[model samples]
Target: MDITIHRPGELTEPLRRAWHRAMDESPEYANPFLAPEFAIGIGRHRAGARVAILREEGEPVGFFPYERDALGVGRAIGLGLSDCQALVHRPGVTWDAQELLRACRLSIFEFDHLVEEQRPFAEHVTGLFASPVIDVKPGDGGYPEWLRGSYPGLAKTTLKKERRLGRDVGEVRFVFDERDPRMLRTLMRWKSAQYRRTGRMDRFARPWIVDVVDHLFHVREEHFTGVLSVLYAGDRPVAAHFGPRSSAVLAAWFTAYDPELRYYSPGLMMHLRTAEAAGRNGVTLVDLGRGDKEYKDWLKTRELRVGEGFAARPHPVAAGYRLWRRPVRGLRNTVLAHPRLRDPADRLLKTVGTLRTSHRADSDGAASGRR
Candidate 1:
C-alpha cells in the first residue's frame, strides 16, 4: 500500500469520490462522522487535522483522518466529539497499523470509538464497550406502527404523557427537520448549562466547537447531512437535538431539554421522536453512542461493540503518552462499569456542581450590589 498524507481540505474531488465509494462498499463505514465532509469541517478549524490516504495500483483505497500535536501524539479527528472512528477502506483491503502510523508521522494514535470490525486495530484495543443502537425498520406501516409493536409499553405511556404535556402546557409539537438556526443556538446553551449543572466540562465553552457545529449545519450532501430536530409546547422550545446523518445512519450526538420540564421527561421524548422521524427520513439505524444511560438501555434494540485504546509504534513519546493517559481512562472506565461505583461518583460530582452554581450566584449578587 502506498500512503499519502494531505490536509483534509487539500483532497481532490476524485479522492473524495473514492472515499465515498469505499464507504458505500462497507456497511461498517457508513457513518457521517467518518465522512470526508466531517473531516474537512474539523480541518477548517483544527490546523493539525490530516487524512492519510491509502492507494493500491495508484488508486485511492482507504482513508484515515487524524489530528496530531507537535509532540507526535495523535488522536482521531474530532476525538471527543465524533462517535465513530475507523480507517475506512474497501472490502478485503488490509494494512499494518504501525506502518500507517509511520506514514501519518505519529508516535501514537488514540481513539475511543473505533469500530469493532477494524481488525487491524484489534491488537491495540485495551477495552471493548457497548454502544447502544436503535435499529429502525420502516416496514409497510411505517414508524408509528412499528413503535407500537416494538415497544408497546413505552409508546403507550409516552404518548399519554405527550397528550398531558400538551393539555397542561400547550400544543406539543415535534419537528423532525427544523431549518431554524436559532434552535441550534438554544441547544448549545441548554447543553452548556446542563454540563455545568452536572459538574461536567462544557463543550460549548469552546468557540471552535460552536463554530464547527454551525459550519456542519450548512453541509447538505447525498452522503452526509447535519440534522436538527426540535420539540415544542405552544411555540416554546422544550427540547432539541442536533446530529449528523449519512444516507443510512444517524448518530445521536447532542440532545438537551429545558430544565424546568424535567418531570415531563422531555429529553426522553426528544429521543423517541427523533428516532421515529429519523427512520422515515431514510436512516436505518440511530447510534446512541458509547455510554451507560438508562434511556439507552430502555430504547436500544441491540448494541454495537466499540473500542478504546492507543495504537502506537515503540517510541519514548508513545510510551510516555500512554503512561500518562491510561490511568485517567482506567478510573473513568471502572466507575462506568459498576453502578455501585458510578452512583457515588455521580453524587460527589453533583455536590460539587451545586456548590459551584451557588458560588456563581453569590458573585453575581455581589456585583449587582456594587452597581
Candidate 2:
C-alpha cells in the first residue's frame, strides 16, 4: 500500500468522486463528517487539516482526514464538533496504524466517536461508548403516521404541546431544511448563550469554527450537505439545528433553542420534527451522537457503539500528550456516566455562570453611570 498526504482542499475532482464512491459502498463511511467537502470546509479555517489517501495498485482506496499541529500531535478533523470519526475506506482495504501515523508525520492521533469497524486502530482504543441514533423508516403512511404508531405516547404529547404552543404563542410550524442565513446567525447566538449558561466552551466564540460553519452552509453535494433545520412559532424562531447530512444519514450537531421557550420543550420538539421531516426527505438515520441525555433515550430507536483513544508511534511527544489528556477525558466520562455526580457538577457550572453574568452586568451598569 502507498499513502499520499495533501491538504483537504487539494483533492481533485477525480479524487472527490472516488471518495464518494467509497462512501456509497459502505454504510459506516456514509457520515457527512467523513466527506471530502467537510474536510475542505475545515481546511479553509484550520491550517493543519490534512487528508491521507491510501492507494493500492495505484488506485485510491481509503481517506484518512486529520489535523496535525507543528508539534506533530494529530487529531481527527473537527474533533470537538464532528460526531463521527473514521478512516473511510472501501472494503478489504487495510493498513497498519503505526505506518499511517508515520505517513501523516504525527506523533499521536487522537480520536473520539470513532466507528467500531476500525480494526487497524482497535488496539489503541481505550473505551467504548453508546451513540444513540434514530432509525428512520418510511411506512405506508410516511414518517408521521409511522412515528405516531411507533411512539404513540410521545407523539401524542409532543403534538399536543405543539398545538398548545401554537395557541399560546402563534402558529407553530416546522421547517426541515431552512436556507436563511439570518436564522443561522440566530442559532449561533442561542447556542453561544446556552454554552455559557452551562459553563461549557462556546464553540462559536472561535473564529475558525465560525468560518467553517459559514463555509459549509454553502456546500451542497451528492454525498454531503450542511443543513440548517428550524422550528418556529409564526415568524419567531424557537429552536434550530445545523448539521451535516449524507444521502442516507444525518449527524445531529449543534442544536439550540430560545431559553424562554424551554417550558414548551422546544428543543425536543425541534428534534422530533427534524427526524420526521428528514425521514420524509430520504434520510434513513439521525445520529443523535454519544451522550446520556434523557431526550436522547426517549427518541432513539437504536444505538451505535463508538470509541475514543489515542494511536501513537512510540514517541515521547505521544506519551506526554496522552498522559496530560487522558486524565481529563476520564474524569469527564466518569461524571457523565453517573447522574449523582453529573447533576452536582451541572449545578456548580450553572452557579458559576450565573455569578459571571451578574458581575458582567454590574460592570456594564457602573460604566454606563460614569459615562
Candidate 3:
C-alpha cells in the first residue's frame, strides 16, 4: 500500500473522479460531507486542510481529509459543522491508522462523527452515539399521501397548523430548492440569533464559516450540491434550511425559523416539508445528525451509530492532546447522555443567554440614545 498527502486543491482531475467513484460505490460514504467537493471547499477556506490519498497498484483507493496545526495536532475537516466524517474508500481498502497518521505527519487525529464502518479506527473509539436518520420514500400520491401513510398522528396536527398559518399570515407555501441569496442571509441571521438565545457558539459570527456557506450555496455538482429550502407564509419567510446533498443523501445541517412565529412550529414544518421534497427529488435518506433533540425523535425512521475519539501515534504531542481534550468531551457527553444532568445544564445556559441578550439590547439602546 502506498500513501501520499496533498493539499485538497492539488488533487488532479483523475483523483477527484476516483474519489467520486469511491463515494458512489459505498452506501455508507454517500454522505455529502465525505464528498471530495466538500473537502475542497473546506480546503479553500482553511489553510491547514490536507488530504491523504491511499493507493495500491498505482490506483487511488482511499481519501482522508483533515486539518493539521504546526504541533501535529489534527482534526477531521469541518469537525464541528460536518455531521458525517470518514476516510472514504473503496471496498476491501484498508490502512494502518498509525501509518496513515505518519504519512500525514500527524500526532493525533480527532473526530466526533466518525462513520461506524471504519474498522481501522475502531479500537481508538471512545464512544458510540446514535445518529438519527430519516429514510425518505416518495409516495405514489405525493407529500400529503406520504405523510398521512407514514405519520398519521403527526400529519393531522401539522396540517392543521399549516392551514392556520395560511389563514393568519397569508398563503403558506414551500420551495424545496430556493435559489434566492437574500433568503440565505436571512437563514444565517436567524441561526445566529438562535445560537445566542441557546447559549451556543454562533457559527455565523465567524467570517470564514459565512464565506464557506456562501461559497457552497453556488456549488452545482453531480456528487454534491447545496440545497436551500424555505417555508413561507403570505410572502413572509417563516422558516428555512440549508444543507448539503450527495446524490442519495441530504444532511440536515443548519435550520432556523422566525422566532416570533414559534407558536406556528415553523421549524418542524420546515423539516417535514424538506423531507417530502427531498424524497420527490430522489434523495433516499435524510441524516438528521448525531444529537438527542426531541425533534430528531419525532422525525427519524431509524438510527445510525457514529463514533467519537482520537486516533494517535505514540508521541508526546499525541498524549498531551488526548489528555487535554478527552476530559472536555467526556464531560459534555455525560451531560448530554443523561437528562438529569442535561436539563439543569440547559436551564443554566438559557439563563446566561437571556442575560447576554438583554445586555446586548441595553447597550444598543444606550448607543442609539447617545446618537
Q: In terms of TM-score, which candidate is stronger, 2 or 3?
A: 3
TM-score of 3: 0.99
Candidate 3 — what's its lDDT? 0.95
Q: Name the better of 1 and 3 by TM-score.
A: 3
- TM-scores for candidates 1 onward, in order: 0.98, 0.97, 0.99
Report every candidate's CA lDDT.
0.93, 0.91, 0.95
* Model 2 ranges with Cα > 4 A deviation: 139-146
Ranking by lDDT: 3, 1, 2
Residue by residue across 244-292, what tens digits does model 3's lDDT show? 9999999999999999999989999999999999999999999999989
Clashes of 2: 0
lDDT of 2 at 180: 98
- Mind giving the per-residue lDDT tens digits that candidate 2 earns over 1-371? 89999998899999999999999999999989889999999999889999999999999999999999999999999999888999999988878999999999999999998999999999999999999999986566854576697678788878788888999889988888899999999999999988888888889999889989988888888788889999989888999999999999998999999999898999988898888888888999999999999989999999999999999998999999999999999999999999999999999998888887788789999999999
User: What TM value does model 2 have?
Assistant: 0.97
In model 1, the Cα lDDT at residue 34 comes to 96
